[model samples]
Target: MDVYYFTEFPYAEFPESEAEKFPSMRLTFPNTYFDPNKAHDLFKRYLDEYQHAEDVGFDGLMINEHHNTPSCMDVEVNITGGILARTTSKAKILMLGNMLPTSDNPPRLAEEIAMLDVISGGRIVSGFVRGIGIESWANNTNPVYNRERFEECHDLIIKAWTTPGPFRWEGKHYQYRAVNPWMLPIQKPHPPVWVPGTGSPETVEWAAKNRYTYAAFLTPLDVAQGLFARYREYAAADGWEAAPDNFAFMVCCHVNDTEEKAQEAGKAFLWRMNHPLRGPREYWSPPGYTSRAGAAAVAQRRPTPLNELSYEELQSRYHLVVGNPDSVTRQLRHIKDTLGVGALLLEAQGGPLSHHDTMRSLELMGREVIPALKD
Candidate 1:
């Protein structure tokens, strides 16, 4: 399995308690807490970490974007994707990914990704996402049109990359009279597309229909297994057998030289599991943002929220993994074996995880954990 290193590129210099003053840490939380100076330093440190992860033998580097949130300072993945493309030579740059529904221009989105692929010498895995409900508010996009815009924007971007453009696009959510961009992806058809989901049935079915990899983000192992099984059912109906490469699993992971030290450092993930995830139902799931079926699946999959779970419960559920190299490798391998996924997107760094601990964990993962899994 390909092991990818990931971080939300968090900006957690502020006190976690500040989130209590707002409905959530995401959309409505005031940016008054933001310190440009601290963020400047954090950005440099995080970029350095990304470069180091590549140097230490990670197969890929993953970055994501979110707006108005301290949990993830990266507001634009393409910007960081371009930087990683130039700085790293070998690691696949997985942008999981650009938000489809919130974007107004599909052709521009296509060009930006294509440019990154060219710059990276064809090492880009393009990930498409239907932004969370908070994003719909932040971008002022209608929640009712979330799924419609997501599908239409995706269709247009794919056409921009593959179909010889100069063609016209007339769709419900997107329209372009002349559809051609001078820049095209270095990868032949386009970069490999991956979609991240957490118990969204329509997402799984859509991904399977396109033969795209479906990454289950932070979902329980059993839930991920079920989602993958559904994907297989879809693929089988289409007369193609899905392989491990068609699926990926993402979880927060940390490794150190000793189990005790790893466990202690792993507690840093609690910051992420808590405040940022606390919000009203409307903030997280606007009325039309999710179908009734999707919401039901999500509730069944995660009956207890991560914030409500103790650290031990989190570990037991596989939402977070922390241990010495040997133990981490064993747990990750079990996930790989159980889900039959092609890749593991490990959030090796998360909320308030210090630079020293993050680097040390990355080093240990490269030296011991990753190789052990490969064997």
Candidate 2:
């Protein structure tokens, strides 16, 4: 399995009690708690960690973006991607990824990603996502148009990358008279496109139809299994076969020298499962952001929120893997064998996880856990 390093770049400088003052920690949570100098330091440290992960032998480094929350400091994945492209040499840069629905400029998005692929010497995995419901509120984008915009924006970006330019693009949501980009990806026909989903049938079908990788993010093993099975079924019906490379899994993970030490550090993951995942239902599932079937599937996907699950419960259900090298490797291997995923997107840096702890964990994964998983 290809192990990828990931982090939300969380800012936990403020007291947790402050989040109680708001209905949700997303969208409406005030940024009064933010401090620029601290965030500047964090950005430096986080980028350093990415570089270190590459040096330590991770196969890929994944970056994501979000708005109006301390949950994810990366407000723009492409910006971070550019930084990684220049800084790192070997690891694939997986931006999971551009929020197509919320973007107003598809051509610019295409140009940016193409530039990243070129800068990275073609080691870029382009991921596309329809931003979550809170993104609708954060960007003031109409939720009803979320899927439509996502599809149209995606089409335009792909065309921008693959089709010969200086052409006209007239779509429902985006239009360009001259679709020529000075920059093009080095990868023939464009870089790989991976889509992450969490119990969204439409997403599975869409990704299958286009032969894109479908990554299941933080879903239960059983739920993710069902989702991938659906994707495979779609591929079969289309008279194609889906390989392990067509699937990936994202989960919170950490490792240390000993099980005891690892358990102590693993407590830090609770901070992420807590406030970042906590909020009013409206904040998470705003009207029209998801199709009815998708919404229903989501409701049944997880019996309880990760926030409500105890640490042991989280590990038991495969939502997280926290242990020494041997145990974490065991758990991750089970996930790989159970789901047939080719890549594991490990959120090794999570809420309040100390820098010292994170670096040590990365070191251990590089020296032991990652190699064990490969075996």
Candidate 3:
């Protein structure tokens, strides 16, 4: 299995208690807490961390974007993707990814990703996402049109990459009279596409239909297994058998010299599990953002939220893994065996996880854990 290193590129220099003053630490959470100077230092440190992860032995580097949240400072993945493309030579740059629904221009989105792929020498995995409800509000996109826009934008971007453009696009959510762009991806049919989800049924079906990898982000192992099974069912119906490469599992993971030290450092993830996840139902799930069935699946998939779970509970459920190299490798291997996933996307850095701990974890993962799993 490919071991990919990931971080939200968090800007958590502010006190966690500040989130209590707002409805949630998301859309309405004031940016008055943001400090440009602190962020400047953090951006440098985080970029160094990404470069180091590649230097060690990680197969890929994963970066994501979010607006109006301290949990992820990277507001644009393509920009970061471009940086990683130039800085690192071996690791695949996975941008999980540009938000399709919120974007008004599919052709521009296509050009940006294509440019990154070109810069990266074809090592780009383009991950498309249906932005969370908070994203709909931040981008001022209608929640009701989220799915429609996502599909249409995705179709247009794919066409821009694959078909000989100069073609016209007329769709409900997007329209272009002349679709032609000089920038095209280095990868032949465009970079590989991956989609991340928690428990959305439609997302699984959609990913399976396109034969793109479906990454289950922070979902319980059992829940991920069920989602993968459903993907297989869809693929089987289409007369193709899905392989491990068709699926990926993402989780918070940390490794250290000892289990005790790892456990202590793992507490840093609680900052991410807590405030940022605390929000009203509407902020998290606008009325039309999710179908009734999708919502039901999500509710059933995670009866207890990550914030509500204790550290031990989180570890027991596989939402977070912390240990020495041997132990972490065992746990991650179990996940790989159980879900039959092709990749493990490990969030090595999260809310307030210090640079010392983060680098140590990455070093140990590269030195011991990753190789053990491969064996």
lDDT of 3: 0.94
TM match of model 2 to true structure = 0.99
Per-candidate Cα RMSD to the true structure, in Å, reads 0.8, 0.8, 0.7
Please, what are the lDDT tens digits per residue for candidate 3 over residues 1-375?
A: 899999998888888888888899899998999999999999999999999999889999999999999899999999999899999999999999889999999999999999999999999999999988999999999999999999999999999999997999989988899999999999998899999999999999999999999999999999999999999999999999999999999999989899899999999998888888889999999989999999998998799988899989999999999999999999999999999999999998977999999999999999899889899
In order, candidate lDDTs are: 0.93, 0.92, 0.94
- In candidate 1, stretches whose alpha carbon ends up further than 4 angstroms from where it belongs are none
After superposing candidate 3, which stretches have Cα over 4 Å from the reference? none
Per-residue C-alpha lDDT of model 1 across residues 38-141, encoded as one tens digit per residue: 99999999999999999999999999988888999989999999999999999999999999999999999999999999999999999999988899988989
Stretches of candidate 2 exceeding 4 Å from the true structure: none
Kindly give the number of clashing pairs for every candidate.
Answer: 0, 0, 0
In candidate 2, position 178 carries an lDDT of 98
